[model samples]
Target: MFDAGLSVEEPVRGVVLLRIDRPQALNALTTASAHGMIELYTRLALRTDMRALILTGAGESAFSTGADLKERAGMDAMAARAQHMAHRLAFSIRRGFDFPVIAALNGIAHAGGAELALSSDLVLAVPHAGFALPEIRRGIMPGMGGTQALTAALGPRRAMELLLTGDALDAETALACGLVNRIVAPEALVSEALALAERIAEAPPLAVSAVTRAVRGAGQGGAEAGLALELALHQRLMASDDRLEGARAFAEKRRPVWKGE
Candidate 1:
C-alpha cells in the first residue's frame, strides 16, 4: 500500500514518519509527489495502529521549495490546474486528519513548503529551516491553500506581509511569529520530532484524536465549546483500560503498558 516516491516508516509505535525523497528537486512537490502524498495520507488514516504522523523531507538542503515549477513548465492551464489541485488535496488531507500531524522541518521551506508546514498540527523546525511564500515574486499567488492556512497560522497582517513581499523568514522569525512551535539544531530534528510524537502517543488514543478534532473546530466555537469537547474526551478516556493502567502505574511507580483502548 506504500509507494517508493516517498519514504514511510514507523520509527515509533502510533507515529508514521513520512519523508519527501526527491532531493534532486529540493524535494519539490511535483504532481506525482502531490498525488502520492494524498494516497499516503489516505492509507495512514485507515491504520488503527497509527495515532499520529510526522512529515519531513530528505537531504540537508530543503524541506521543500514548494511546487516544482520546472515540472509544470510547458503544461497547459488545465494541466497546471489539475496539478495544483493534487497538491491542495494533499495538504488538505494532512490538515484534516483525525490524528495529530507534526512537521519536522529540516531545511528551507519556501512557497509551497511553508504551506505544507502550515497544514500540520505542530511544527518543529531546525535552526536553519527558513520559511517563506515567494510566489508573488514569481508572478503568482500560492495556490495550494497557502493563503488561508498561512493567515490562520500567523495573523492576516503578517501573512499578507510575507506573501506580498515574497521574502524569506528565517527560523528565528518564524518562531517569533508563532508560525513554528519550536526550533532546534538540524542534527536533532528527527529525534526531537519522534520524541514529541512518542509523548503524544502515550496518552489515550481516542482522547488524542478527539482533542485534535475539537481544537481544529475552534473557529466554529469559542473556548467554552472547546473546553466542553475536551471534558467529553477526558470522560471517555477515563473509562478506557489504558487510563486504568496509567493510573495504577502512576501509583505503583512503574511504566504502564498502554493498550490504546
Candidate 2:
C-alpha cells in the first residue's frame, strides 16, 4: 500500500498525510516516486473514510525541488517520454481525488513541485517556502500541468512573466499572487494543515465531494454548465440521509452526525 520513497500516515482519523521521503535530494521526485504518488491517490479514492489529505516533504529543506534531473540526464528520449507520461498521470490522479488535499509547502517547490501544489485544493507554506517554474532554465518547458494551473492561479500575464523569467516566488509573493493560501512558521506548517484538514473532515462527506466537483466544474466550464452540474449534485444530496441529519442538527443546535449517506 506504500513505498520507501513515500510515507503515508494517518495522524488523525480520516486525515491522510503523504510525505515525499527523499529529503537528501530535496525530495525531488524520481520516476518511481511519481508512480508511487499516483498509486497512493488512486487507492485513497476508494476509501469512504478518508476525508482529507495533506501532502508535504519529509524535511524542512523542501517540499520538493521538482523532478530528479540527475535521473533524467541518463535517460534516453523514449525513457524521458515515459517519465513525462507518468508525471501527467500522477497529477491527474491527484486532481481526481474526491477528498480535499492540502499542500504543506515547507520549503522550495519548483517546476513539477509547483504543479503539485497547484493541484491541491489548499496550499499552506512556511515563511521560507518558495515556488517557481524553472523548466525554462533547463531548456524545456513545464510539461506537468504547470502552464495551465499557473495561468489559472495567477493571470496569464503574471504566469508568463514567471515562466519566461524562471524566477522564484517567495512565500509572500506567492500569497500575493494567490498561488498559496497562507504562510505559517515551518514548525507550525504540519499542525496548521492538520487542523484545517480536520475542520474539512467534519463536514458531510457527500456534500464535500459535491462541492469539490461543482467548483472544479465552474473553473473548467461555463457558468451555466457549472450551475447545472451543481444543481444535479445538490438534488442528489437532498435525498440523502445525511441531508436530513444536517437539517435536524441545525434545528436542534447540535453538530450534524454525518453518515456519509
Candidate 3:
C-alpha cells in the first residue's frame, strides 16, 4: 500500500479509492499530493484486476481547494515551473486511467479541486457539495485541464462564464447543468460511488474497455472512423476469453467469472 502523502483504500474488490488527506488544509493539493496522485493513477492503470477508481477527499468540508498556493508561496521561478509540471502530471494521471474513474464529491471542490472532480468519468456529488473555478479571483485561470474538460462537459457559453467570473455553483445547479452525474447525501457518497463502480466492474472487462475506447474515439473523428473503431473493438471483445466465460455461464445459468482477458 503506497501512502503517497494521501490515503488510498480499496473497500470494494476491483475498485480503488483515493482520498485527499490534507483535511486541515481542506484537502488542498500540495506538490507532494499532486505527485502522489499521478503515481497512484499510473500504477493502477497497469493492474489487470482493477476495474475502476474512485477519488474523494477525507472530510465533508471540501473535496479539494485545488493547488496549495500557500505551499508554493515565495517559491522561485524554477520551483513554480516544477510545481506546474507536477500539477499537469496529476491531471494526466486521471486522464490516462484506462478503467472508469469516478469522483465522489463529498463537499466543496474549488479551483484545482473542482478541476479534479470534473476530470473523472463520472462525478457523484453530495447534495450540498459545491463546485467552482475561482482562479480568476486570484488573477489567474485554471492551470489544470479544467478549462478543457469543463468546456467539453458544459459547453463554451457556460464554461466561459464560469471561468471568467469565478462563480461557484451549488450541487443542485451543477447537476442541472450536467456537471455532475448524480447527487446524494454526504454520508452516502462513497457507498453510491462504490455501488456504481461494482455494477460496471461486474461486466466483462474487455467490453468495458472497448466501450471506453469507442466513446473516446468518437470525439476525434467523423462517424465513419468512429464506427470502424467500434466495430473492430466489438469483434476483438467478442473473441476474448471473458466472452467465452460469459457464454458458458449463461448456458449454465450462473454468473460469469471474468478472466480480464
Strongest candidate by lDDT:
2
Q: What tens digits encode model 1's per-residue C-alpha lDDT throughout 92-165?
A: 77777778989999899988888888777899998888988899998899887788877877878988988899
Global lDDT of each model? Answer: 0.85, 0.89, 0.85
Q: What is the C-alpha RMSD of each candidate to the true structure, in Å?
A: 2.4, 1.3, 1.9
Model 3 lowest lDDT segment of ten: 212-221
**TM-score of predicted structure 3:** 0.92
Q: List candidate 3 segments past 4 Å from native.
A: 1-5, 222-225
In candidate 3, the residue pairs with backbone N, CA or C atoms under 3 Å apart (3 or more residues apart, or in different chains) clash, namely: 66-113
lDDT of 2 by residue, 106-205 (tens): 8999889888898788999999999989999889999878898899888899989999999999999999988889999888999999999998998899
Structure candidate 2, residue pairs in collision: none
lDDT (10s digit) by residue, model 3, range 1-261: 555448999888789998888888989888888788777877887787888889999888999998888977878979977988898887876676668888999899999899888877789999879999999988788878788878877889999999999999999999998989989988888999999999999888888878876775665568889889999999998788998899999999998998778
- Each model's total of backbone clashes: 0, 0, 1
Pairwise lDDT winner, candidates 2 and 3: 2
What is the TM-score ranking, best to worst? 2, 3, 1
Candidate 1 wrong stretches, greater than 4 Å: 1-4, 221-228, 244-254
Q: Please list the residue runs of candidate 2 whose C-alpha ends up more than 4 Å from where it truly belongs after superposition.
A: 1-3
